[model samples]
Target chain A: MTAGYVDEMHEAFQTDLVYRSEDVPLECSPKPKDLEQTLHGLMKLNGLVIRSLEEIAGRGANAVTYRAGKKFGHEVAQYFQKRDDVEGALHELSDLLRGQYSFEVWKPEDKDSYIIEENGETFIYLVFHDCIVRQTLRRNGLDQGGPLCQTLFGYVVGAIEEITGRKAKLEIVHTGPNACLKKLVLK
Target chain B: MEIHVDKDACVGCGLCVKDCPMHVYELQNNVSVAVRPNNCMGCLSCHEICPAQALEHRGIYAAKRHYIDIHVCEMLKKVI
Candidate 1:
C-alpha cells in the first residue's frame, strides 16, 4: 500500500510539474519511503503546532482549529485518491489548500498585550510570522497553507491507516492549547 | 524564447512557484506572475495545468505547441 501510494504520489508530482512555469526540481521523485517519512513527520509537527496555537489562541480555540484542520485532512485523502501522479495530487491538494479558515493573534484592537483566558485559556494571538506565511501562501493562491496543512496531516494519517490496515481516529478539537492527537474533529 | 504566465488565467496555485527549480515563478495577488521569464528553463509544467491554460511558452519551444494533448498523454501512458 505504501509503495502504491508512493507510486501514485510520484506520478502526481510529475504531472503537477508539467503545470509549472519552469522545469521541476530534478530532486522530485517517486520515493515512497521518503514521502512516508515526510508525511509522518509533518503530521506530527502540525499536531504540535496546533497545540501551540491552542495555547496561544486560548479559550478552547483548539476546537475551532481542530475542526478546520480535520476538514482539510479529508480533502487531502480525496486528493491523493484522485490523482494518478504526484503532480495531480499536488494540484488537487493545492486546490484543497485554497479553502478558507480564520486564525487570529493578539492585536492592539483586542489589546496590545496577550491575555490568558478561562479553560486554562489565554490571549487569542495570531503570530506575525505565521500570518506572513499564511499571507504568502494565499497571496496568489500558490501555497494553500491552511488547506495544505490540514490535508498533509490527513494525508499522513490516511497513509498510515493504509499501511497498518487499522482504522485510526483523530479528533483534535478541545484537546487544549497544548493537547496533541492522532485524529482531529472540528468543534 | 521566453514564457509568460497569463495573469488573467493564473489561479496562483504556486505549483509553478515551488516547482520551478529555476526560481523563476512567483505569486502575485493570488495569481502566478512570471517575473524572470528569461530564466525559464523551458519546462512546460506551467503550460500543462494552468487550469485556465493561461501559460504560453514562446521563443524556443513555441513550435512544439500541441505536440501532446494532456488527455492523450495520460491515455498513452496507460498503453505504454
Candidate 2:
C-alpha cells in the first residue's frame, strides 16, 4: 500500500499491484517507461513522506531521517574498498550517490586543497548542487535545513566513516535554492 | 560573481544582509548593497529569502533542475 510495501508484500502481491520494486523480480519486469513515474510525482511523493514524518515526530523526524540515510549510506559504502584519503573517499562517495546528491568540493579562492585544517582540526567543504531533497522541499513549499536535509548530512557522514574507517560529522554551513554548503568534519 | 541590488525594488528590509552567511551584503543608506561580492558562495539564499525579489547574481553556476518533469519543460519551452 505504501512506497516500500511492494517489497514487503512481494510474495503475495503481483506485478500490477506493485508500484515500485527495489530488487529485480522475474515475475514482472517493469521497464522505466512502464513505471508511469514522473519527476514531479516522485518529488511530491518524497514531500509527502517528509511531511508525514514531520507531523508524526515533530523535530525528531530529523533523527529518523538521518538514521535511515546513514543506514543507506553504510549499505552503499560496503560495495567499495576502503579509501586512504578524504579525496578518494569523497570521489567514491560521489560516484555512489551520483544523481541523488550531486556535489563538488568547495574551497576559498586562495585555497588549493579541498581539505582544510582549522585550529588543528580537519574538515572539507562540500557544495551540493543537484539534490533531490532540495527539489522535494521546494515542491512541498518547505524550508531548507530541516529533517530532510539532515538525511543528507547523515548520509555523507555515514559514507565517509564507512569508507575512511574514521568517524565523521556533517554540518550545514548554508542552504539556498540552487545549492547548499556543508562542512564534513573528520574525527 | 557580480551581485546587483536593484535600488528601485529594494525595501531596505535587511533580510539579505541578515541571511547571507558570507556577509556579502550590508545595509548602506538603509538599502542592501553587495559589500563583499567575492565572499559570496553563490548559494542564492538571499535570492529566495528576499521578499521583494530584489537581488540578482550574474556569472554564477546554475545547478541542474533534474527534478523538473520533461513534459513541463517542453510545455514551458513553447510558452517562453
Candidate 3:
C-alpha cells in the first residue's frame, strides 16, 4: 500500500515544472537509477561551483562572500590558499551541516508544498528548477551566450540524500519570474 | 626535501589534505599546515586545486619557485 502511494506520488510530482531560465530544462522527472553515481555527480557539481569562484579569484579578484539568508546564515568566503582534495570539502560540509544547519525550514506557504521545521530555522524544499544553475552564473557574471541548458539538480538532490540518508519527497513546479527549483523539508 | 606553503595565496580550502594520499595536512585554525611533509609524493594535485595558488610540491627534481603569489604570501604569514 505504501509503495503504491510512493510510486503514484513520484509519477504525479515528477511531471511538474520547477523554474524556467533561458534554455535550461526543468528537473521535473525521475532521478537517476544509481544513487552513488548521482552522489559523485553532485560532488563534481560542488567542485565546479568552487572552481568557478576559484577562477575568479585567480584573476586577482578578491574573494566574494555570499549569504544564502539566515536559512544559510553561514558565509561562503573564498581565499587564495593551499588546495585540498574533494574529501576535504565534503568533510567540511558535513561538519558545517552537523554543527550549524541541521535545523532550518522554509517560510510558510499555503500551496500544496508542506513546510515543516526540521531542527531550527533550516528549511528544505524539494523544488524543481528548469535552469537556476545557469541563471545563477549569469547573475554572477557569466554570459553563457545561449540559453544555458544543463541538468545538475539531480546531482544536488543525490548529494542531499547522501547527507541526510532519507528519501526525498520530490515535486515539480512551473516557471516563475525568478529561478527556484523545489522546496524540500525533512520528512 | 623542503616544503613551502605560499601563505598569502593560500585560500586554505583544504583540498590538498583530502587529496593527500599520505595524509600530510591538517587545518590549524583556518590554514593548512603540512603535518607530514614527507608523505607528499611531490604530487601537484594540491597545486592544481589550490584556488589561491598557495601550495606547491618540490620533489628532488623540482627547483624552488613561486607556486602561489608572493603578495598573498606576505599578507597571510602575518595574519597567521
Candidate 4:
C-alpha cells in the first residue's frame, strides 16, 4: 500500500513538473527512505527546541515558536515549488510527509469540507487523529493548541500562500490531545 | 493487535465510541466496548479521550515516543 502510494505521488509530482515548465531540468530526487529519516531528525530537533523555549519563556514562547515554524514551512514550500506548481507541490508534500512521519491518520471529517471550489477559491478541511504533536504535549502535561501545534498551522499557511500565489487564511476550529480539525482557505 | 477495556474504570461516557474514526468502539448497555478490534489503526484516540484511562492497546504501532530531558526530569524529581 505504501509503495503504491509513494509511486503515485512520484508520478504525479513528475507529471506536474513537466506540465509546469518544459525548460526545467529533471533529476532524481532523494529516496523516500532518506527523506523520511531526515524529516524524523528535523521533527525531533524542532520539538526539542520548541519544548525548551516553552519551558523558559512560558506563554510568551508561543509567538516565537509559531514564527519559527512559519519560516520553516515557507522554506519547505519554496523547495517544493522547484518541481511543481504551488498547489500540486503542497499536496504531494503533505501526503509524502504524512506517510513517512507516521504522525497521525488524517481523515476527511465532512464531505463539504473535503474539497470545495467556488468563485475562484478553494477550501480544504482535514482532521488529524493521534497526532504526534498532541501526543508530545499530553505526555508533557501541556495544553493542546500550543506553539507545537501552531507549527503545523504555519506550515499549511505558508504552503497555501505559495500555491495560491495569494495569502491564504488557516484556522483551527477544534483541537484535543487525540484529534484536531484544520481548515485552509485559498482565494 | 489487542485492545483491552477495563470494565471497572469505565464511566460509560461514550466519548471513545463517538470519537473513533474507524468505529472500533461501540456502546453496549451504556458501556463502551471494542467490537471491531481489527478496524483499529492504533491511533489511540480512544486512549487519550477516555476519562478513566480505561483502554490499553498492545501490538500496535505506538509511534515514536519523545521524552523530556533526563537531567531536567531528575532535577525535578529531587525538587518534588
Candidate 5:
C-alpha cells in the first residue's frame, strides 16, 4: 500500500473512534438457517436488493446502500448473539455466511488477540478472501470500491454491534478485487 | 494455488500486475505470470481485469460461483 493511502486509512480509523459512540439496542430476533436451500434463497434476495439499489441510485448512492446493508448484517448478528457469546457468535456467523458465499474467513487464532485495546479503544479484525460481494460487483461491471459493495461493510459493522452490544465503526483497510481486510472498532 | 495464463489469448495488458495487492503477477517475456502462487489470496481480481479472458485459477478458495451470470460463465467456458 502507498504511504498516502495508509495515512488516509489511519486518519479514518481515528476519526471513527472519536465521532461514532452511540450504541444500538439489541432487541432483534435471530434467525438461523438449517438448510442450504434457505441460505441460497437469502443470498439471491440480497443480491437482488443490492443490484436494484445500484441501478436506481447510481454510484453516488453508495452510502445509503451501505447503510441498508449494514442494517441487515446487524440483524443477522443479533440472531447469532442469542445463542452464543460475542466471540462464539462472531465465529459461528462467519462460518455460516462463508458457506453461503463460498469464501474463506480468517480470524485471529489467539482469542485474546481477537480484541485489541490501544489508547482506550478496542477493535476486531475480519479478513475475507474470495468475497461474493467483490465477485458480484465485477459481474455488474463495477469496481470493488463501488457503493454497491458497501453493503458488506455495513453488514459487518451492524453484526459486530449486535454481538458485542456496543456501537462500533468499521474501517476498511485493504480492498482488492478478491480480498478485503477490515477493522471494527468499538466506539 | 495455480494460475494458468492462456498464452494464445493474453494481450499482455499488465492490468493483473497493477491490480493485484499481493504482487502475485509479474510481466515475463511480455506476458503476465503468477510468480507468487502462495501469496495469491484467490480474490480473482486479476481474472476480472484481464481484457483477453486469458486467466484461470485452480485450488484457490472459490467464492460462491453464482455471482457470475450463469449464461455468461457458460459461454466464456466454451470460448476459453
Candidate 6:
C-alpha cells in the first residue's frame, strides 16, 4: 500500500465518526444463494492465495501475516471501549468475536475453572468454533495451524492488549476440523 | 456429552486413538472406546479421520461449517 493509504487507514482509527446502517432496498439486495456462492468463491480464492504464499514466502509468511493481523486487529479494537480487568475484557471480547468468527471461552467439563492464575498472570482458553480462517483452510484442503492461523493469534493478542492495556500472548493448544483451542495469557 | 463408538462399523484402524490430541479414545479388544471421554474438547478430529465413520458425538457444539458448498452437500446426500 502507498504511504498515503497507510496514513489514511491509521488516521481512521482515531476518528469518532458515527455511522448509521440502513437496510438495502429489495432491488439492491442480492439473492441468498447468489451471496453464498460469492462467499464460497471468495473463500476459495483466499485459500489459493494463502497456499501460494506458503509456497513462495515459506516460513516468513507467518510473521508477515501475523504483523498484518495485529495491525488490523489493533485498529478494530478501537471500536470497543477499554476495560479495567481481564475478566471484563474476556466477557466483552467473547461477544465481539462472534457471529462470523464465533469464539467461546472454553474449558474442560471436569475442570471447575476456565481461567487459571499464576505468577501474577491470568490464563484462559479460547475456542474458535466457527472461524472463517478455518473454513478457508479446510475449503482449500490445507492443514490447520499454519501461517493463516498465526494471523488469528496475532489478532487475539492485539485485541486483548488494546482492550485491557496489558501485554497478552496466545498459544495454540490444539486444532481440529470443527474447533481449535488456544490459550491466552494476560500479564 | 455422549460419545458413541459403533463397534459394528469400527475397522479398528486406531486412527481416532492416535489423532485425538486429548487422547480421549483407546482401542480395546479391537474396538474404539471413549476411555477418556471427560477430557474430550469436542474438536471432532477423530470423527473426521475415521475411515469407517464409526464415531458419533452427541450433545456437543457443532461448529458452523458454511465452507461446505451447498451444491456439494446436495451431491453427497444423493451419493450416500
DockQ winner: 6
Looking at model 2, residue B71 earns an lDDT score of: 73
- Candidate 1's C-alpha runs over 4 A off are A1-187, B62-80
- lDDT of prediction 4: 0.65
lDDT tens digits by residue: candidate 1, A1-187: 6999989888875743335567666765757444644543444565456556656776455346545645545544543454333324333433443433222222223234433253543322222111222332322233232333444344433532333333434322211111111222111
lDDT of 2 by residue, A1-187 (tens): 7867777788575556645668666764467555545667877888889889899999899999999889888988988989878899999999998878788888876567778988888989888988889988887788889988988888888898899999999999989989898899988
lDDT of 3 by residue, A75-180 (tens): 2312112124323333443344342122122222333333445456333443222233433443344432112212232333334444444433323222221223
Error of 1 at B30 (Å): 1.4
Output the worst ten-in-a-row residue range by lDDT, candidate 1 chain A: A173-182
Arrange candidates by TM-score, descending: 6, 2, 5, 4, 1, 3
How high is the lDDT of residue A160 in model 1? 28
What TM-score would you report for chain A in candidate 3?
0.27
Tell me the interface RMSD of every candidate, in Å: 20.8, 1.9, 21.0, 6.0, 4.6, 1.5
For the predicted complex of model 4, DockQ is: 0.10
- CA error at residue B72 for candidate 5, angstroms: 7.9
lDDT of 6 by residue, B1-80 (tens): 78999999999999999888777899999999998887777888888899999999888888888788879889999999
What is the CA-based DockQ of model 3? 0.02
As a whole number from 0 to 100, the lDDT of residue A37 in candidate 1 is 48
DockQ of each: 0.02, 0.48, 0.02, 0.10, 0.25, 0.65
TM-score of model 4 vs. true structure: 0.51
Which candidate number has the best TM-score? 6
| Candidate 6 lDDT over residue span A9-84, tens digit each | 9998885856558744556347765688888888889888888898999999999888977887788887898997
Error of 2 at A15 (Å): 17
Computed on C-alpha atoms, the DockQ of candidate 6 is 0.65
Candidate 4 residue runs with Cα over 4 Å from true position = A1-60, A82-87, A95-113, A116-122, A127-139, A173-180, B1-9, B14-28, B33-43, B51-62, B66-80
- Where does candidate 4 clash, by residue pair? none
**In model 2, what lDDT does residue B52 have?**
91
True contacts kept of each: 0.00, 0.57, 0.00, 0.06, 0.41, 0.76
Question: How many Å off is the CA of A96 in candidate 5?
Answer: 5.1
